[model samples]
Target: MSKTLHHGLLLLRVLSEQPQGLTVSELADAISVHRTVAHRLVRTLEAHELCRRDHQRRIVLGTGLVSLAEPVQQDLRTLARPILDELAESTRATAHLLVRDGAARMRALMVVEPRGALVHVSFRPGQTHSIEQGSGGVAVLAHGPHREGERPEVSEARAKGYAVTTGEVIPAVTGISAAVPARDRTATASIGISVFEYTDLGQLGTTVAAAARSLGRLLD
Candidate 1:
């Protein structure tokens, strides 16, 4: 890849971690580029409306990315809809599709609640949290090679083909997830369900893992 393009992408990645925005000097330091080069890159991004200067002169991701991302998100939702709906109905819980953001965060891309279910967990899409915080995150982390000092949940997920946790994302709730394999290395995602209670963890795990494998085949 061209050095300029590489640095530009790195700049955007760095800016994504700081929702409040970052100064050009801080951006340069974050991306290991010179201040002048960072300025030129930021200006180029600003021209494309990919990044913009805030009132405080800090650079933040611009609205342009939303327009670019919407269609992709929609397509993913469309492809996963039937599977997620089946998972939700079979598991009798709220099923969700989550995608990795940067290196340490997971965002819910879509959510499906079981039809005719009374008193099921319900959460909106776009919920973002630490990659280590919940079953969905750990399930996604289980993809790729194992890392030293990784969480036990991740290791367990890798071995068992699914992950389970209780009260991690929300109090009194249980989550089960399995990683959805993708052809693109950069595209990390998971399929999961959240419930208030469940007696058969093994069955739930098997169901979710099967759903994940089905989705993974489609994604690949």
Candidate 2:
């Protein structure tokens, strides 16, 4: 396969395992390449915020994916901005909007940061995640979000209505995500929230579920 495709798939596989985002070195070994090569591959993914570097020099999931998924969400933000904003204001935490590009790629976002910690923002619009790397990505995958006409794990999630991704994508980051069925069969979309992995644990689950419901209403 071409290097671009190779790295892209590798990045995806890495995130699929869990939210414990991979390090350049770890990712390098997974694909049987040199660390330097893996580092470069990660950088490519980073351009889309599919991965991010952490204090330990490890790669973590990013919030840059929201913007890339604008179309998939069908302008969920545009239509639901008021509700989303109110939720953000009430939660005082970051809120995310995400969608999958059906085997093409996945995108996410951390649209509004809590007013108190806007400076401590975690994700920006247009951030993309390697479907292979984080709970954010895996949440979509676990829910059987399609890619290239394949629904990976949506059935399981459909039976469950929500997917909880932890330590699979980002080591210190966890994400909770839920999908909103779409009219288009070719692709599917979901909305989720991500935060540092070290918080009260359950908080990640609770907040994400609430945010997802808030967004789900927009689509309905």
Candidate 3:
């Protein structure tokens, strides 16, 4: 990639991790670029409405990204809706579709609450967490080729066909997830459920894995 383009992308990524925004000097240090170069890149991003300066004079992601992201998110949500609804209803829990944001993090792309459940876990879509932190992320990691020093839970998930975690993303809650196989696509994602109490792990895991496979076939 062109050097300028590379730096620009890097700057955006750094800004993403810090939602409150960052000063140009902080952005330069974050991306390992000079202050002037960072400022220029930020200006270019501003021109495209990709990033903007806050009232605090800190650079932040622009609303333009919402326009760019919505269509793609909507397409994924549309495709996964029935599957997620079925999974949520069947499991009597809150089901979520999570996608890898990059190498190190996963983002909740969609969330569905069980229709008939009187009490179910609830969380907003668009939450992000480390790839090693929660069942959703670990399941995605399990689906990918093994890497040195990866969390042991990833390997365990690979062997078991799903991942399970407790109080990782939310205290006192249990999460189980299975990766949606990538097949021929670049997308990497997982389907999962969250419950307030621990229940049948094997049954839940199998159910989640089946849902993930079904979704994978659709993606294929």
Top of the candidates by TM-score: 1
- Model 3 Cα lDDT, one tens digit per residue, 1-220: 6999999988888877787889999999999999999999999999999999999999988988879888877887898999999999888999999987655788999999998788999899889998889999999888878889988898999899999998999998999999998676433899999999855889999999999999888877
Better of 1 and 3 by TM-score: 1
Instruction: Find the candidate with the highest lDDT and give its number.
Output: 1
TM-score of 1: 0.86
Ranking by lDDT: 1, 3, 2
lDDT minimum window of 10 residues, candidate 2: 180-189
**How would you encode candidate 1's per-residue C-alpha lDDT over 9-121 as one tens digit per residue?**
99988888787889999999999999999999999999999999989999999888878888987888888999999999998899999988656789999999999998899
User: Candidate 3, clashing residue pairs?
Assistant: none
User: At residue 40, what lDDT does model 3 achieve?
Assistant: 94
In the order shown, the candidates' Cα RMSDs to the true structure are: 2.5, 11.1, 4.0
**Candidate 1 vs candidate 2, lDDT winner:** 1
Q: Would you give me the overall lDDT of model 3? A: 0.89
Residue-level lDDT of model 2, residues 129-217, one tens digit each, is: 66655545555565554446533444444455555555664565556566544444222455555555334545545555565656555
